[model samples]
Target: MHAIVLVGGKATRLWPRTRWQPKALVKIGHYSILEIIIRRLRDCGFDRITLCIAHLGDMIKDEFGDGRHLGVAVDYCAEERPLGTAAPLHLVPDWTSPAVVMNGDILTTIDFADLHRQHTTSGNLLTVAFHKSLLHAGVGVLRVRDGRVQQIWEKPNVEWNINAGIYVADPRVRDHIPRSDAADMPGLINALLADGQQVTGYGFSGQWYDIGTPFRYQKAMKEFLTHPDRYLRPDAPSNGNGRRNEVALEPDGDRLSVADLSPWS
Candidate 1:
């Protein structure tokens, strides 16, 4: 199956590090986040991949030229201006078949083949990957009736199924996205739902991380170091070494500073 990876965001939240480069080039161990994502897609038998790039797109083009090294055919759709998440789908070339669309910064072990199969057979225009996330209240909560407290639950946990930034979209869904202006995925989904089009959510129970911020990046690094086998390819030499690979960071007294490690190292 074909796939479209969105790597266009400025990623301002990951400032300083992202100030100079796109988040797609952010390193996790010896591989950049984009490399890991491409490798994952290749492993799942996706032969055709297209990257929708805007910010610092030239760097990405220079890094993964033609995708030949990764054993997949790679193409690029360079947006002249920033197009939000789902709008870039309209830029994909010959995107007549059902395809996988996802964020470039996400690190997950989700099975893409299964998602493709489910979407194809279910007759839905769109199938979104979802994960259950817990929302914890910071302060105490109380149930009051007639100005009298009947029950009190402190720091309650609310379980919510959130969008996992991955989607299987039918070719027809592209019609919903405007040709001009920016559009996000949530807006697309809501439009589909409002029109009574079939939109399904596929829940996955696996390791998933959206490395959009420094905290999340560090957390993903730690998890990947702790359990490399779960995230790395079976043949990856670092999978079973049980060793912590050094990332591109060094101690700056009490703080940490970015180091100049080769992204492909």
Candidate 2:
């Protein structure tokens, strides 16, 4: 499967930690967040990958120039301006296959190949992966009727099936995005709905973490050291020396632009 990993967020929520490097380049263990994600994708049978990058994109392009080092072919699409989440899809030249698009900061063990397989069979234009999460209301919430308070619940734990920031989209989905403005996946989903295209939600449980906040980042770091096996496959490709095999990039100079480089051939 050809996968597009969105790595271009400003990540203002991550602040100084991402001040110098894009969140995808932030290192949690022996590898950067993007590196581990790509490695996991490779393990799940994805061989062609493209990164949609912006903030500190040049560094990302330099670090994984051709993706050969990771046992897959890699290409890059740089967003000259922030394109939200889905707009960057327009920047890519073309990836004809049904593809899974993911947020750069997410670390998950979902089998992307399987996700694509399901998308093909569902007859849906879009299939989104969702994970359940509980959030505290923090303050008492009340039900009101005619200036009278119905029962009050204090700090309820709300259960929700949150978007995992991962999706399998048909190539034609891009046709819905206009080249003029920034668009996000949510907007794209809504557009698909308005156009009468079918969309689906795939819910599953797994070791998934969105390293968007410092607390979450710290938690991932701790959990990974304690249970690396949960996230990484023992059979995943690796160099005998105990690290991943990687390729060196050509000497860097000027910054890159949208669709400037590809490894499709």
Candidate 3:
């Protein structure tokens, strides 16, 4: 199956550092976030990947060019403007098969192949990997008989679930995205749910982090560095220069728009 990686965010929250590089290029441990994600996709037997890039897109293109060196065939679709998560799929051609889509800035150990297989077997139009979190919930106070405190129980935090930014989508779902504007992924999923289209959620209990802000970025970097074996690739050295040593197929500033220098072959 093909994979689509969203590599185009302004990354304003990661300012000063991302002011020059795309968030995907941000290094965690020895590998750039992009490299780690791509390696994971490859590890799960995925190739023929498509990178939907916007800001600093060329830099991403230059870095991963064709993907052959990394044991995959990489292609790119450049968006002139920021298209929300689900819209870029419309810009890619011929990936008619079910595809895996993910945010470029995430670090996760979830099994991509399993997620894809599950999506197909369940016969859902879309399936999202989800995680659960608990927030502090106040205890319940009960006033009984004559306004006397009858019961006081510590409030338990409510359980909340969220999408993990990993998705499996049918090509037909492209019909829901508009030709332009900030058409988003969540809205599309909501539309599918409302229409009774098959949409599923897969619970994943794995290491996952959204590396969009400086704090998260630092956290991811520290985690990977301290536990390198958990995330490092076989070919990657432990000395931690893998990111800097990576071959640049293209390099462009994320916030500053630049011309596409990718070789058309």
Candidate 4:
């Protein structure tokens, strides 16, 4: 199946480090973030990949040309201008099937195969992966009746299903996107809702991290290092010995075969 990874953003939050390289190129242990994501997706059956890139896109193109090194057919869709999140979908050439769309900066053990299966069965135009995030209303929140306070919650912690930056969208769904302005996933979902199209959510309990900041990147790296096996599947191809610096790409001491993209080393 086809998968599109959005790696175009400037990632302004991750300045200095990102000032030099895109967030997807940032490394966790020995593997670049995007490389790891590709491997996981490959394990689950996503063979055709398209990288949606803008800022430092040439560098990304240089890093994984044709995706042959990673055992996947990797191509790119360069954004001539900044197209927010969902807007880049227009540039993905030839839309025939439902493709998995996600940001390149996330680290999660989401089962892409399962996600696709669910989407096929449900016949939804759009299916987004969701994670439970705690919404903290930091300031005083009061529900008053004219003048009397009916309810007041201080620093309330509400659980909400947040978009996990991952989606399985039908080819027809792209019809909802307008070519005029930059758009994001939220706007697309709202438009679909207005059109009465089916949109579903798939929640995962596995580890999920967004490495858009230094602290979060460090923390995610630590977590992945602590339990590398949990996130990487055994199905992806590995280099000889398959053993990288720390993470075991193969189980039972067997290693996933990978080409030594010396530059990455």
Candidate 5:
């Protein structure tokens, strides 16, 4: 399967860090966000990857070059002007079916293959990945409508689901995106909903984080450090024997064997 990542956002929320590098290049623990996504997608049997880039497009191309080093071939669709999330997918020429699309700012362990399979077999125009969130408690005082005193309510938490900004979209859906620079994903979804297209939501109950803001970017790194096993791809080596610096890569042949090298150490 082929995958396209929307890496074009300027990431103004992450100013200084993003001033020097694109959000996709922003570090989360040991690897950049783009690298993590690309590696995970490759592990899930996706070999062809295309990055949609606008701001600092060259930096992304220079950093990952051909995707060869990451065990996946890379291609790029540079948006001359910032084309909103779903619009850029229209730039790819030979996309025959629904393709995996994801935001470059996320750090996740979602199985892309599963998400894609759900979209294809279900015959939906689009598939969205969402996560159920647990809300935190808050303290508040309430007044009664009658003369009787109203009860005080303590902080309470709630649960809800939110869009994770990853999608598997049918190529036919591209027609819904407008030809404007400011067009975004929300507008596309609203159009699909109004048009009565079959858009299904796929729930992912696993590790996922959007490193869009400074707080989230930092928090993600700390979280990964604490629970490295949950975030890093299983194909990547573990720090099981107190060795937290090396990863085994078969750059040549495709077999599950390890050859140790001190490249990063």
Candidate 6:
């Protein structure tokens, strides 16, 4: 199966660290986030991969050069400008088989092969990977009717199924994306849903991290440092001392205020 990995975000939330480098090049452990994603895709039996790149794209091209070292045939789809998320699908070559599309900065142990199997057999136009997330209100809340307080709920937790930045789509799914404008994944999914197309969400529970912000980057670094084995492949080669050397976390800089520029919801 072909995997279209989107590695072309400005990553404004990561600030000065990503000011000169692409988010894909950010190091989590010993390997860059892009390398880890490629290795995982290869392990999942995806032999052909396409990287949609922009924002210091040359560095990413220089680093992964043909993907020979990673045991996969690598190809690239360069974006002249920021094309949201789903718009890039229109830039990539058409596919006859189901293709997996995901953000390149995600750190997860998701089983792509299983995802593909489910997507293909279900006969859905699109299958999105979803993870359960909880949002907690930081302060107490009150409900009032007219001049009287009806009820109050303090610090309630809201549960939601979040899009995990991964998707398996049929070839026809591309028809919904606009050819000359910015269109996001949420918009595309909504279009499909409004047209009565079959769209389903596959739920997963495991180690998943979206390394887009400083908080998430630091969290992923700490998780990999503490539980290196969970992030590393079992077949990965070990040092002569029979242990894998963990990569040091990069130093944190002053936090920068980032606008909500996420293309995906």
Please rank every candidate by lDDT, starting with the best. Answer: 1, 4, 6, 2, 5, 3
Better of 4 and 6 by lDDT: 4
lDDT by candidate, in order shown: 0.80, 0.77, 0.74, 0.79, 0.75, 0.77
Tens-place lDDT per residue, model 5, 1-265, is 8999999988989998888788998877778889888888888889989999999999999999998888999999888887788788778767887789889988776777778887787787888887645555465433344455444334434344568898888888878887665577778888999998867778666667888888888888887787766555644433221111112333232111111111221
- Candidate 2: clashing residue pairs, number: 1
Candidate 4 TM-score, true structure as reference? 0.81
Candidate 3 error regions (>4 Å): 136-153, 233-265
**Per-residue alpha-carbon lDDT of model 4 for 1-265, expressed as tens digits?**
9999999999999898899999899999988999989998888898999999999999999999999988899988989899898999999987689999999999887778877878777788998887654456577555555576655556555545556899999988779998888999899999999998868777665568888788999999998897777568633322211100222122111111121111232
Q: What is the TM-score of each candidate against the true structure?
A: 0.81, 0.80, 0.80, 0.81, 0.80, 0.80
Clash count, predicted structure 4: 7
Q: Return the lDDT, model 2, position 163.
A: 80
Query: Candidate 2 — which residues are off by over 4 angstroms?
Result: 134-158, 234-265
lDDT of 6 by residue, 165-210 (tens): 9999887888898888988999999999999987877766657899
Runs off by more than 4 Å, candidate 5: 139-156, 234-265
lDDT of candidate 3 over 1-265, digit per residue (tens)? 7998888887989887888988888888668899988887887789778999999988888899989999999998988987889888888878788899888988876777778888888787888877544445455423255555553334434344557898989898887777767677898898898878868777665567888777888888887887765554533332321111112223222211011211221
Query: Candidate 2, residues 174-224: lDDT per residue as tens digits?
Result: 888878999999999999989998787775555678899999998888767
lDDT of 6 at 58: 94
The C-alpha RMSD of each candidate to the native structure, in angstroms, is: 12.2, 14.3, 14.2, 13.1, 14.1, 10.3
Give the better candidate number (2 or 3) by lDDT. Answer: 2
Which segments of model 4 are wrong by more than 4 Å? 133-157, 234-265
Pick by lDDT: which candidate is best?
1
lDDT of model 2 at residue 70?
A: 88
